[model samples]
Target chain A: MSPLSITSRTLAAALGGYGLASLSAMALAVTLPMARDQAVIIGIMVALLLCSGAAIWAFSARSAWRAWAGILAPGVLLGGLYLWGLPA
Target chain B: MNKSFRQSMAWLHTWTGLLLGWLLVAIFITGTSAYFREEITLWMQPEVHDSTLQPGTIDMALAALNAKAPDARSWDISLPGPRQTAAELRWQPAKPPEDGRRHRGEQILMDADSGEVVAPRATRGGNFFYRFHFELYGIDRLWARLLVCLATMFMLIAIISGVITHKKIFKDFFTFRPGKGQRSWLDAHNATAVLALPYHFMITYSGLLLFMTLIMPWGIDAAYENDRRSFFSEVFSRGEDAAQPGSPGEMVAIGPLIEQTETRFGKPVERIQITNPNRDNAQITLRVNRDPAVTDRQRGGDPTQVFQGNTGELIDTHIPANDPVSPGWRIYNFFTSVHMTRFADPLTRWLFFLFGVAGSAMTVTGMLLWVSKRTQQLRRDQQPDRALKMVNGLNMASITGLMLAIAAYFLANRLLPVTLAAREDREIQVFFIVWLVSLVHGLLRPNRHGWIEQVAAASLLWFAIPVVNIFTTASHLFTPLAWQHAAIASFDLVCLILAALGGHTLWRLQRKPLPAKARRAPAPRPFNTTNPASEQPAGESP
Candidate 1:
């Protein structure tokens, strides 16, 4: 793939991941406050840190797969946290 | 200097910008208006005009509050001063055992002298615009905030890539060559982006940081274990817990407290918070700080001091200039100040306003750049491709459509039935609905027609705003001008001028017919050009 396409895809993926992390973090912040649930809040915070790291990596990395993985990890992890740990 | 890198950056700039250009337009418009939030509030409420400034002591205000709301849990009084006409009072009723959210509160606008509630109407004043930028109406606030963050991210990339794409950033700093098609658009985008680079950077970064809790709450969550009050107190040194009463007795008079607060702060008291006003545990916390010049210097830092309720003792004072707290605090304050323009003098505010206009222009020109480049390419290829056509349509809707939607918001503010459910929200609904309608219209119409029609419609709506205000309400340009409310009057005139500018733009674009050469196929060279008889005279070719 062309460098431009790679960069665009990487940026889009990073944004998608950041979106999920932010949504999960927000859910935790709101729901945790009401439920007095600390564990879920911590879980979301850990997911956010991972997402921030992925964004940084995606921004700096040259390899396409590495950039894609860097961008995708946060979204996948947040999804897992929401599905398993969070109440519907 | 690398051609490929430049090409890649150009591609990055174009797409990144296009993806978020409409959102950025809304942010720029709303953000710019937010600078004049107080002025807008002044304009909205015509009933409270130039009231007498109250000189009564804080003790008198506290006495009034105690009499009015004896059983209230917390009472807040905004002292009547120069900028504000009425002494505003707020108090929370006893919270029910069921939920904290059901606590009843009242915002009383007092007669500066008698301290009686007068002209009490629930109206979203200038604060609406200020809050609207981050918290868009209808949708979840978190969603709106997240969208703004995403836009800011795209904006940062666009600005960086835009600088790299510009070959003559310095040389074309002041250059503006109108009627030069793509060159003019590029020059416009470059000039605005470069001239206000610092403003753009500071505003976008600060906007992100303003909601840093939402964006990056991990640090606060981990450190304070997600306890909001503790997190705020630790970072701001606010000291959340109030002092317990030493001995249960009648509270001391607020007049002496006011005197002590004024003597210590050397500024007029702006607000006073009373805890347990009627009870023996009552404490009046007088906040003395309201010099915009000095407060602006503090950036986003709280420049006020809190005093003990009973003894009038100093509790806590925050002087942002005296010491640097945390790096986070300083950064947060700097950005917040930039966003709020609280530090801005009139001239500086105007400069920020002008730069805001330039920022809006940059987004419009960027969209135009895409359309202009694609049109040129399609003309060269001798066919209008489907992708190019769709882009052209989107450019029309995104640019002019946004202007129309903003105008629609103003119109809705005036025309919507006052009794409508969630009236303030209805104005925002009109804004989005109008914009969506324009988008759908653009999709249906021919690209050329869409541009002309949407711009014309926007111009009309914009021009109609002041006229509507004049007819619908007592506050018009004439009255405000007569009263020497320059801020309010000038705001209306500025809108008119913008409308006129939009009209002129639409007129020019509509007048220029599509070039015939752009539509027709290129002529083939004569086959028998080498034969002298067959070849016509150079200028006489059929």
Candidate 2:
């Protein structure tokens, strides 16, 4: 099977992209020095934009593995940092 | 695997559009209708056709409420305004039952003049179409919302990719040739799309934005520790008040409070809510019905004002979102206003509805174009494929069949007995059953017969609505319609227009049968695949 088949791209975008967006939103919410309500609101907008970009990138990428890596690497880093010592 | 940007975008556009186009069409149609949902709901309930808004209506309503729910804890009176024909009144007891489905009170419609109960039909108001627009029926709210969001995202992707693929699309807007088979469809698709390009983009993006928090609430969940209410309180400043246990105090006249509220705000009041009525802790809250500004700031503008119930003295008031709003609330409200069109005037509402219909037409035409192209290919290589057959049937089912189902739904509302329990749910059930039957009808024929039959049925039903309304209710198309109650006449007119349009299209389809040009050779070969199936690939010409 081709590495950049539509099916693989879909999986990477939906799963990996979703994880990245979710993790980044949490990280921003915790780290931003603004009020929590403001931080969360801004974080959500950022996450949505990031998610849309990831989806577009997933389909446009030459290989599906790169799509997965592009999303999951940042996702895991933020997720790990969140787990370590991020404020609620 | 290797393709140019435009080619890749073309591929994405076709797939994404095909994958979610049916649902998109459904959403567009229902949502567009929801823009006129108030009119549709009024048409459905003919009981309040004569109850026009007049002077002294507020005083009458106040007297009615004071007499009806004297000992009640709270009184909420929504005076008749745009989209509403009657003064909607509700009151709550000090000790209320735990019923979340309905509002927290015994609700009833009060006539503006006499303050008599205007018992309209028990059907779900314009709320049905509005709710169905986002959260479709027969599903959990969360699940329905998520499904709609997913489809919306796919539609966004399709729109973006489509723009990329159609580089000279602007030129196509000015180019259209009638009577040419594929050219006509392309022209139609391009014309409708390009004409309402901005509206389509705005509506689609705002639709996605409307459900942003529900779609991406991780940040909110984390910040508020999964408590959504706290975030809501902080962002949207709801009028938080407490009721005290005090002895019964001399109640002040509501007419004075109403006068004071209107005078104080320099705007017409739409509703008033009295918490702890007739008690020392009573508070009167007045809501502005219409924003004086040409354009509304937020979805429901903060034109809410609270007054001391006993003294009729103003306590607090909130203006529109001009005040400081929490982080993303402004953007959220902007998108919401665009999507909901709640702030739109009648003319703007009509434009939105028309654009929505045009968008639906574009989707339907695109689907038909796809089928026609495939049919040509099938004729060139004559072997019946299951997928092509299924697509043909599904298109007929969703496009025209849904219209038939909506018509049937209206007919059911009039025919069903008012005394029947769960009549609203049953009416919805009738709608789905009729839709399901039409789908079966589509699968059975999938040709000229299917198209003609379903469109004809829908047209007849559209015509029959006004006829039935005249016979069953007081309102009709040709009757003398007053300006205040013009919605009823307008409803009838809209139906007549739909009937004429449907009839004209059906007549044209029957006269020409455009599909004949596309599927001349593959017309009757769906069932007979023995001899022709053998020599299928022999004459394959690209």
Candidate 3:
């Protein structure tokens, strides 16, 4: 659409990619022993989902907020969990 | 984004990648090798033939240490196990009063049986390789680390910008067109970078964080009041807090302590440090850890226990998984774990090794891309541009010449006398001298010829390593292989394979036809004529 929107979309996608990676890593870290493996598998799955979501948002979203939402949702969730639930 | 922003980023990505690519390749190569530093040490020392340690060897080793280094402030004894040869004792004397310079500790290599000092060897063991990646020889460690840090930051930027620049990122995910010069280099770079994107990101970011104290020291320095030891202890869970040393008392038997450590951890005691050993407040810290392994992540969840030196009583315990550390600290640990791969099994180590090679390939291709892209412009310009030529020379020297230097270092390890004074330092000296020599060779030769020559030299050196080992060592590849000795033979074989690849590369370079377009002389300019009749007459004659 508009150049501003496209730039916002690109930034959103970049953030989304970073969010996916961080969340996947954090999820794997918090889960203990046997559940850790399962957590990592889930994390990988989630990361892929987020990555695909970002791609779709880049192409399809008419509004910049929607593109940003695709990334921010995962980023905020991951950051919150890491700060609050991290093992001592 | 505006075209200027995109263009600026593109320029940033290109130059940053080009400038740092060679250093990055060195880093990846050394880092990967550092994963097998212990194995390399084992290969270097043929005198300690087998992995097994003699019974009561550690006790005897300690007796020697007590006798030789009684005045020393602290003694660290590393017990011989599967990965190392000889029980080694290191003791650092107090700083001298006049100059206040600390002496580099005395290292006594004890015989496994008699516990007498063996002929001193100069090899710095496997740890040197680990140290080489961050603390490059001849450079201050702080400066080297900073350089590495800058390189890593640029690398991260390049990775991010590269992804942004790739228009068909997913569509060309698996594409690799083999022989189309510049296009092929781009394809190779993209494939390597994309396929291992996770590895690339983790490695680059973790590498940067590896020196985070240097990069972002405000938190750690402010918190610890700039006390590095305290910071380390708090972060790494090192050194127990104990009461002041009491009067000298009878020390307890270390055998039971060793047995206790082994039994508790299901791993052999790697090292034992007795703090204030002569006093009643003596504390024995038994370091029982898993044999270092190579994996995607190096340090795994393992516990380190400390016990009282005299009573064999438990003092304190540090388990990385259970330690109360900040998220930043844990993140740092996670990066180290990934970088060192100490927790990995053999199969996983192989995976990391392959990835390390892929990382090296990414750097090499990036450098090659610089030259490949500029070749067209240089050809179009009748005369060879000096700046482009210099860039071409530097790319060749760094990419191929560094490999030759490393090969030369391996050769020097074999050639250098073991009994020579400061032998370890000498070996390291050889490494730098050879590297410097390669830089000179690169600068002096024609750019294209330099690559061929350096690659050929590297190939020869790699080929020679096994033959030299066979001549010098008792264990050769033909001998029945054991787990402890397999690394030595395998390393040699890997060198040979590298040599073969280098040879093939050199051969291909030799065979490349000179550019047909570049070879043609520039079209002669027609003589200027003011007379219109003359110009028409020329056209008519033609």
Higher-scoring candidate on lDDT, 1 or 2: 2
Candidate 3 regions with alpha-carbon error over 4 angstroms: A1-88, B1-8, B49-51, B70-75, B92-105, B124-132, B219-237, B240-245, B290-321, B324-328, B377-383, B478-484, B514-518, B521-542
Q: Which candidate, 1 or 3, has the higher TM-score? A: 1
Candidate 2 has a DockQ of: 0.50
Better of 2 and 3 by lDDT: 2
Residue-level lDDT tens digits of model 1 in B140-248: 9889889888788678667766776777888888898666566666677788888888888777766766666777775345434557776554444544444443444
TM-score of chain A of each: 0.52, 0.84, 0.69
Highest lDDT scorer: 2
Provide i-RMS per model in Å. Answer: 8.9, 2.3, 11.5
- Candidate with better TM-score, 1 vs 2: 2
**What residue pairs clash in candidate 2, if any at all?**
none
Estimate candidate 1's alpha-carbon lDDT, on a 0 to 1 scale: 0.63
Candidate 2 lDDT over B66-147, as tens digits, reads 7887777788888887677888888886666766643457888877767688888789856787888799988999999999
lDDT of 2 at B92: 80
By TM-score, the candidates rank as 2, 1, 3
